[model samples]
Target: MGTNQVEMCPVARLIFVVYLLVTTCSASPPNFVLLFADDLGFGDLGCYGHPTSITPNLDRLAADGLRFTDFYCTSPVCSPSRASLLTGRYQTRSGVYPGVFYPGSRGGLPLNETTIAEVLKPLGYATAAMGKWHLGLGQNGMYLPTRQGFDHFLGVPYSHDMGPCQNLTCFPPDIKCFGHCDQDVVTIPLMYDDIIKQQPVDFLDLERAYSDFATDFITMSAKKKQPFFLYYPSHHTHYPQFAGPGAAGWSRRGPFGDSLLEFDSTVGNLLSTLENTGVLNNTLILFTADNGPELMRMSRGGNAGLLKCGKGTTYEGGMREPAIAYWPGIITPGVTHELASTLDILPTFAKLAGAKLPMVQLDGVDMTDILVNQGPSKREAMMFYPTDPSVRYGMFALRLGKYKAHFYTRGAGHSETTPDHDCHIISILTPHDPPLLFDLESDPSENYPLSLQGRPDLQALLQKIQAVREKFEATMEFGESQIDKGIDPNLEPCCTPQCTPKPSCCQCD
Candidate 1:
């Protein structure tokens, strides 16, 4: 038979070639699991250099793959940031820009906007979103995860803290106050698909449940030989930082650290599940945060490392996040300071899965070359937006190469040491009649501002900003992000066939 193999002739060789092609074409696509955390800072994990939080699994994952020192979220807040992350479009362009869409708000990410799930669905990936769904809960049934292309959904409709116990009047709430935590005070509905699984799930029970859901989903997909995409927007390291039972005070960092520990454990468990299922090698896992730390809570809030300020600001500490990508043998293990953002997740995944890209303008680019080949990313410059998109007072930064220009600065999103705000932001504008510039490479802190009087670099930066601004305004007609208007709160859709129950707490976090 061995001798006959060579003697079989040209037709046999052609048949073998065709067999190889068919086998390769029908091979399973890489399974994707996006572990996105809420309010996690730039220096919150052991892999990212936090002294107190020991995240061994994440650290090992980083060691086994790639870690990014300068990844960013599109918005400083949750809803808009999540929208940008899912669509790969700037939050402003997504029209979800006025701010987060509240529970009663009729606004949602327009169905026209393509999410990573929608892109992968046509390619046969079984997609599920297992945690926070802050984009929209429109009554028109237009904005829920079920409508957004996710095959399965579990977790809250929005932030765990948007409960009835909201600290609306007393933000940076008092320790004694239950604010967004006490189930009696406020309860974010924990849903399984569109039906309410639990109207008021104990906040402490979330991380463990999400991990269980994710692990089971992975196992089921593996058994079926189907590719899976798990978009888990974790509810840890966020406000009312409640650790699950037996997890409190597990770390020296206090309750926040305890919460982080729980999240870390889940990561370890998920990886083990992947390995046990024999899919670890072919899976593409990404870990990142929605935005930076919430600095109002002091020690309870996360540390943003050397980056200044924290959440709700356009500053580095607010938008810049710690990012890691892992695949057993595919991605080269290393670290890079390349500028990347959550906006790139959609495009990069689509590129890897052989899925079709949305026809709209996308702010994110494929970083597959950077992830696997250790090659430079095509991302050249990144545009930073104001903390409040409603008022364009110019508190923004535009990065070109190694230089960044500050078009505006204010006292609102100041350093951690800054006091609790009282409904008014004290403007501390950095001179921008002709914006201030900073060489982020030399001065990562933005301590010294460069004069833009007659420098070529300044002219180049301004020209770049102008070009970006033009494009930003091109789609400014505001498509479906009318989150504040047309809110009937009556048309909400669900999975229980014609379900139309209005969501309870759609308020902002």
Candidate 2:
């Protein structure tokens, strides 16, 4: 009888091993739905302690997922930040430094760079970019999302608020007001798979339309039994924060609040689609912003809570963003203080999907263990890139563990209004000879700069950072499109009814 029991145990173990292999193979790889917001602040959502923004959907999503409080964006502005998130490399390495591109810029993500979608394509994932493709309007669709691995691309070629209109009523009148300058400037084209679907699309109609496109993509992907990667970079919460008819006046905070309400609905609709398609539990939805907020707009923009300064600066408020990752039944719901960034998403998703990574050096570390088993993130250091400066000393910060050293101090809480092309670009940055050091663990707001007179350790840390910066800046390459130039309105895609009342030939699409 004892011999029989031993033999039965061996048989039981074999069956168990086979059973594990079968079940794991039957389970599908988790789908990825990256919801990227533009110019959203840390304190914009109820979960992040906003006083008035109605973001129940986002708040609930945060409650159901891992909320990362210390997450950061690679750059403080749009184009470079977008580049870092897609390629998981620094703006300097990717040649996307100094600034964002306007429409029809000759620069974009180089064709050689491997995007997250490109790497995941071999893994049978259906990829689609459903909103805000702010990475330059490539020459002849050279750098378009469709060319960069997205099966379908639908969004504006650039920002919604870049066009030829010069109406004073478009925004608070200023010679520098490049956005919301009228129905024309803010009314950029809407695109669908390389075709300009409509020139000067109503900005108010976009959020809902993007939501529809996202939901439809999810339904079709689920039906086809293919795990999908949907990059929904929403254009709301930027400038001209307009809401659709159903979402208008939904919040008490004004147009920004109305935009938040509509944005919340967009999340709710996407959640419903996931739930309806039975993919909610098998999908990982990462919600975060490209950068902090546009602070120059005062109350019209966003609030970064206790973080100092705002967009286009190297301050904490400019780069630190609110991030959440939701994968029901997979990621244990909770908040994490781990230091992560948008750069980590590409590598993390690669590991999650069991896909082969590109044979390129990456600035991002795989955060899979931290996301899945709540393990410690091995990320120890992060370098901060100033918003739009070609020179290294203009403004840059380097974070090593809890201590952060700022090589250059810049304007804080001041709006840099480009009044005209002739005016010198507004900048508050002042060169720091010895650099400023702050213990981020104690001073998250960075209000009080530490006295390096007594702390040799801090001084040595700064020296180390300076050495790293010197080595990095030596290899820095700049792209032609990233030279901080606004789009020539003449290059704006297609004309509105007023621009060409009866267009039968040019830009008819």
Candidate 3:
């Protein structure tokens, strides 16, 4: 009998239908899960050479796929870095430069700019964003994740430390509160889409809540046989650190380490969900941080391994981050030191998902070859911009091949006694006439600057860097600075059952 003519039992028909669904999903476009950590250092994970930080899941992820030794975020601070990452362009191009967006800032990433989510959504991907979204919240929440192309959004509007927190005991005693720690300060809202679900979030439960939400999203997408893009920018290891119940005091590195452990566990949970849902092999997972460690936090902050300086500087420690790419059957397991940046994510994902590039000019190049076949990196040079608001549209450093030139050098102070000390305030902003050059391959810590007095080769290198810089700046069109916009109290979100006093009294279970 022909296959079509053969009569089958109900059980057999059900089994056949399930087989077809699985086969179709396997042949479909791959899913994407990007895990972005806040203020996590290059040396924070066990895979990245952290001696005390417990990160078994991340370690496993590295072992199973590609581990990048020299990956970077375009900017050294939160908002600018995130803006560049999503748009695949420089933060200055998107107008998210000068600094991060405050809670009441009306400005946001320009609506004209395209994001990775927007690129994938038209291709039938279900996109979700969990954890921090410091981009901005424009009038009536017009620039939130929902408007930014994410199908589901659940997280804080900005940094966790932006709001009031009466309790100091949750953090390690050694970690001083550099931000708001009083009850009188504006309360940070825990948002679900555009709605403020909870005010003054119980941070102790945040990690768990985020994990649960992400897992649910993954499972739901898998059941519907839909491709998904999960952008989980974790808030752990940021200031005012707090760990979930399971991870508190679980690591020897104190609260910072404990928070990382909780983040690692959450990673484990997501990976397990992918595997259980039978989509692990079909998913392209990437784990990276927004920027370098917050060294000002002292003992409470993360370690940058051998890299110099930390957040708020153009040094390697400030922009270089730990990055891992995992795709079970697609990406070969190995370590690569090829130059790459967060900017490459959007373009690379577009290439992989068969999505069209946005009309706007993009600073990022596709690194799909590197991810798939262990090919050489498409990027050759990278620019380092200042995070300080005082320095506007300035390229402080540039790295070409193995040589890095620092036209300007500044250090973000790391001192426990001086709480207010920052890069712009304490450190001298030194501009080099010839520009200080360093061989990053030999000196990742940037301790030694090469002398170019009598060396023709070094002189040529500097000239080449200058040429590159000139060409880069010649075509550069800086957008209006969104971060410079002053804050507005009226823009702050309030819960559904509005309270008498507004945000301060806005609370929900």
Q: For candidate 1, lDDT tens digit of each residue in 1-509?
A: 00101132456446544543553366587789898999998889988888889788889888887888778898777888898899998777667866666545677787788999999999788999988888887664467888999988998777767665453321122332235443322245678777767655555566778888988899999999998899988888787676666566568887788778888888898999999999998788999998878886777778778776777776677788999999875666788777788999999998777778999888899997677655566787777776456434433777766777767655444234544331114445454656667777677656678876778867877788667756655644444446556544344322232332323442222
lDDT of 3 at 278: 98
Cα error, candidate 2, residue 350 (Å)? 0.5
CA lDDT scores, all candidates in order: 0.73, 0.75, 0.82
Per-residue lDDT over 1-509 for candidate 3, one digit per residue giving the tens place of the 0 to 100 score: 00111233466556544543564345467899999999988888898887888999999999988899889998888999999999999998888977888777889998888999999998789999999999998798888999998998999988887767644335443333345553444577789999888776767678888989999999999999899999999988887778866888789998888888889999999999999999998899998999988887876778788887778788888899999999885666778888899999999999777789999888999997677655578897999988753334368899998899988887664322222333433677888888888998899888789998799999998889999989888867888889778778677666643456755665566
Q: Judge candidate 1 against the unseen true structure and give its global Cα lDDT, from 0 to 1.
A: 0.73
The alpha-carbon deviation from the true structure for residue 341 of candidate 2, after best TM-score superposition, in angstroms, is 0.6
Clashes of 2: 0
> Who is ahead in TM-score, 2 or 3?
3
- List the candidate 3 regions with Cα displacement exceeding 4 Å: 1-27, 168-185, 389-393, 413-424, 496-503
**Which pairs in model 1 have colliding backbones?**
102-506, 103-506, 107-483, 139-491, 139-492, 140-491, 141-493, 164-186
Please identify which of the two predictions, 1 or 3, would achieve the higher TM-score against the true structure: 3
TM-score sort, best first? 3, 2, 1
